[model samples]
Target: MPRWFNTAGPCRADHHYMLPALRRLPEVLPLIGQESYFVLHAPRQVGKTTALRALAEELTASGRYAALHVSCEEGEAAGDDFAEAQRAILSRIRRSAEIYLPAELHPPPFPPSPDISLLGTALAAWARVCPRPLVLFFDEIDALRGQSLLNVLRQLRSGYSDRPTAFPASVVLCGLRDVRDYKVTTDSRGHLGTSSPFNIKVESLTLRNFTRDEVEELYQQHTHDTGQVFLPEAIDRAFYWTQGQPWLVNALARQMVEKLVPDRGQALTAAHVDAAKEILLRRQDTHLDSLAERLREPRVRRILEPLLAGLALGEVPADDLRFVQDLGLVRLAPAGGLEVANPLYREVIPRVLANTAFASLPPQSITWLRADGRLDTERLMEAFLAFWRQHGQPLLGTAPYHEIAPHLVLMAFLHRVANGGGTLEREYAIGTGRMDLCLRHGPDTLALELKVWRDGEKDPLEDGLVQLDGYLAGLGLDSGWLVIFDRRTGQPPIAERTRAVAATTSTGRRVTVVRA
Candidate 1:
């Protein structure tokens, strides 16, 4: 059995690999047939390159079309110099065609240094001699900037009429954003006219995450190959945290099968999954780091702030919206809302951005509330109240996370106390307008709800207590804390006040309100 999963795709050894079969959508296969110029897009590491490469291989192997996959990423460092970028692309294709296709298949008829643009001549030439119709895949096509990308797309458009005969029959522009979002500048006017570049795309396909069942199926592959069975909850946790993002799903499974699980002694479990998540996030591996990088962009921040606050924005431009979605920073909610893409992202992105704010605090001291050395809910909240009173405002400002900074800081503090020293479970939903922190210490469990309240509004205590009480009762828990940050209070010193359990709901749930 192999020691690692193929996460990046295909049979490659250097990149982490996952099965190529899982990434391709059935809808894309038909589009490949119509000789259409389509777009395949997703955030980095979502397998755009891998899927296209595998698809190209699949199509070419069928002997139906002459499929070729070429990467535009190689020329990306050339910057906005469209000519240099075009040269890089043509040279790359010439080399790939020679290696992958028959030598007699005929190279593109363009002159080595043509007076005309290399893109048009190259496509025209490649079509003339091919024994069969051609399928062209321009991977990382978005890497081309300004006129270069526009030129390539427009050249393809001009040649579209010759498809299945004089030009490549089918073309795919693969990148992070859709071709339509491209703001190509032509003739120096910066106008998106009817005949502008990048206007000739048909199908737009996004490679989606593995479904819940697909995740289990992939894990079953590992188990069958290596005899490493994942505990049921391990699979559940994997789906919950990653939502089947290809790289993360494979990475988690790889680490579990290879390192986290004991040597054929213990099954993989949720506890292991939880710990592995922290390890992967803390390592700031390339995948996680890239996701974190998008948060720093101003456009990203504009879209994300309201998302974090559970407020909806009106009429966001399609480009900025797609940009964040492509980055995997947000996901489409089932009810037509936007949400953080996944649980791990929701948990870790803030920490990655807000590391400085959290780092400034002294390490928290965890005291087991029970004499039997288990999690102490009462004591934890006691610690949190004091912590919030003294350090909440400073932490909020310094925290790198722009959204949900206050709530996450409090959770970080609680995690430092509970998970850091004792045992606790953290649960949350993206874009759900609420944060749920559950701490389990031995037989006792603490469920805390955090919210921000507007100053002019009436005391949320009545509603807050009812909510917390019901949440606790549902779990058969007697006590819980509902902490509401008074936004009207601004950054003032903490109120250091607590509302005792003076009231009971009709269902008899106990609720304690804390304003710290």
Candidate 2:
């Protein structure tokens, strides 16, 4: 049977076209040799479990250690009941060992005890009886929280010195966060603290997404199995869109092959990749949906709100920025600062946030279309001005992030305009102080830049025009719009303040300046 792309669970070599799992994790074996306890973390679906499981199998096969991968996810339901969580975790480990380890390496039965502190004693006994030095990978360790989470970490720390004989020689705690970020309550009274309970960790390692070459190599595995091929442009576009995110890379290929084009004789192209991307964005599959759920989190919002508004992140904690990066939602920009992790995420964030406002917008006709079905920029601008006059105030309240309220309202209106067989794209970055929009319909392309004029700041028209000029140059256009939203106190009503005027940029680009 031919192997295919995998989007769910751990990738099996016999059934999935996967990169060499162990090869991707180069630090695990060396750490184990040093008898080091460490943390392995990454965003969800980035293949942490698959790599750890494969490493455990390889280690066991080498006849030097009894290695096992056990999940603490089941214990999550036990909540703060450390005793119940301990039982569930031990049961999970027993089941996993029976399936993955040789009979002699299987841990002996746990002592029947209701005391929560006995977890360390049970593990110490297992290590003493096991035929070889034991190695344990605790997958999804962060799934435990509160007292349950604290108890587990404390138990492990209590057994730290007993390793190599009375306890596992090396233990790997695998989860979505580094140990320092783990939130635990100190007492039953519910006082919270951000301290590492598992302070014995030698290092914290993160699993990185595949590189462009790795993505190409993964796709070539499918070409080797079947006669189908992904064109070079398609591969490049896929990498650019996803930045080699593991699940996204696989999902795009799976979508193209299984849903878009199934015939082996049909070669995949960049257009197919684009269509697949649209489908995924519209469908909001489990992975993207999970990411969207993070938007509601306070820490996530602290960094993302200003990001979408194109403002400098003000006084955000360094750990907060690092947390978002670890979650794979953003990355350090090459120029400086942080940005949405990839083009795909950059597209998904605003669309997801604007979805509710888009639904609330009244039905709009395609009156801005010319006789030849091309989009008319002037007519579209007039229509948007009218829309802003009528509904922008009410719609702005629906946005979850107040810093980007105007931006979201405008995006909602544009979404409605582009609903009729047109495409809209957006670009913003930290400290840009503007949001750039591109609308493509048939042969017409409209470039729009949005800026907010606050009370303390001077007029934004000059800077907006200059920025829009550079943006237009990049798009090979000679003209565009610089929209200045007057948000200063004591300003006239939006209807009274809104109007458009013709202006020229310093770079000699003709710009229609819209003050609204």
Candidate 3:
């Protein structure tokens, strides 16, 4: 069968182009061999289940152990009902064992036990009767909630002593988060807080996104299969854009080959890769939508708001930071601070944050273009000034994120300007004190910097000019716009203050400074 990129569930070798699963997280096998209990965590759809399942099959096939993969997701429906959750989980284990194991290695029936301790007793019973040592990969273990999650972790810890004989030799809890972040809401017990319930775990590991070389290697599998080639620049573009996010890597290839250019004779180029990225962003596929959904979370908002506006991240909880990282929303940058995990996220965050305002907007009336269909920066500025004078205040209330409301409104308007034919790119970071934008519309490119002049603060016009001067330099442009939103008390209404004027920066750059 022809192999293809996989964007859905676990990658099956028979159906998908894939790298060796165990190779991604090499520590897994050694820990299993040491009879260690650990946590395997990564963002959703990053192949945690696929890797763990492949390892289990490999261990069983090697004749060293009887191993199985199962999910605790089914048990989620039982809520805090520990007995029901255990029954659901144990049933999955028995079913998997029957399918994946030889008859002798299959679990003996789950023994009767109390509701609270059923999982521990059941595992002990399975290990006692099976001829070979058992290894368990508990996927989506975080899905269990409240007392249910706490009970399961306790049960695993309780059975930690009798490895390879009375209990499973190794157990791995797999989920989108480490065990500590599974803050289940229960009536009796408060949050999980910093302490993980599964304290017996020796190590917590994560499946990493593919490296640049692996990205090329995986794409090479496609060329070898279809006799089509992904050009070198195209491969570089993929890595540059996705930064090796597994689902995105596959999804980009899948969308390009499957829809954009179906011909096997054509070589995919950087342009094709760029088109694929735009399509993925505009279509808002399941994986990207799931990520955007997290923007609604308060903890997620707390970190991202300042990051989006290019300001300091105020006092945030450590676990909240870890939680956001675990969700794959952000990562530590090469220069040493946090950044949105990749370019895809950087685009999605603002667009998703401004969704309500974007939807609330009526059709844009300004032509915003020359007769030749090229973007006119002057006309675009005029349109923004006119629109802000009339609709900006009302639209601010439409945005869900209060801290970055001005940022979201402008992004929403820019989304309209760059809607069909071009792209608007955003750049912001901690302590930058402004958000920078690069809008590409046909042959024209416009650079913009946004700053807020809040109450009790001096004007940001000078700071915005300096900041925008640096931004335009990076883009290698001679000119740009510096926008200072006057949000201070006793300022004139937005209609009265919204105006644009040209100014020169310290770097001798022509800047359109808009104080609105």
lDDT of 2: 0.87
Q: Return the TM-score for each candidate structure.
A: 0.85, 0.96, 0.97
Task: Estimate, for each residue in 287-362, the C-alpha lDDT of model 3 and write its tens digit.
Answer: 9999988887877888888888777887998888888999999998989888999987888888888889999886
Q: All candidates: CA RMSD in angstroms?
A: 4.0, 2.2, 1.7
The window of 10 residues in a row where model 3 has the poorest summed lDDT is 186-195
CA-lDDT, candidates in order: 0.70, 0.87, 0.87
Clashes of each: 10, 0, 0
Which runs of model 3 end up more than 4 angstroms from their true locations?
186-190
- Ranked candidates (TM-score, high to low): 3, 2, 1
Reference-based lDDT, residue 468, model 3: 86
Measured with C-alpha atoms, the lDDT of residue 483 in candidate 3 is: 86
How would you encode candidate 2's per-residue C-alpha lDDT over 87-198 as one tens digit per residue?
8999898899999999998888777655677678788889999989999999999888788988999889888998989989999999887876665653322322343677
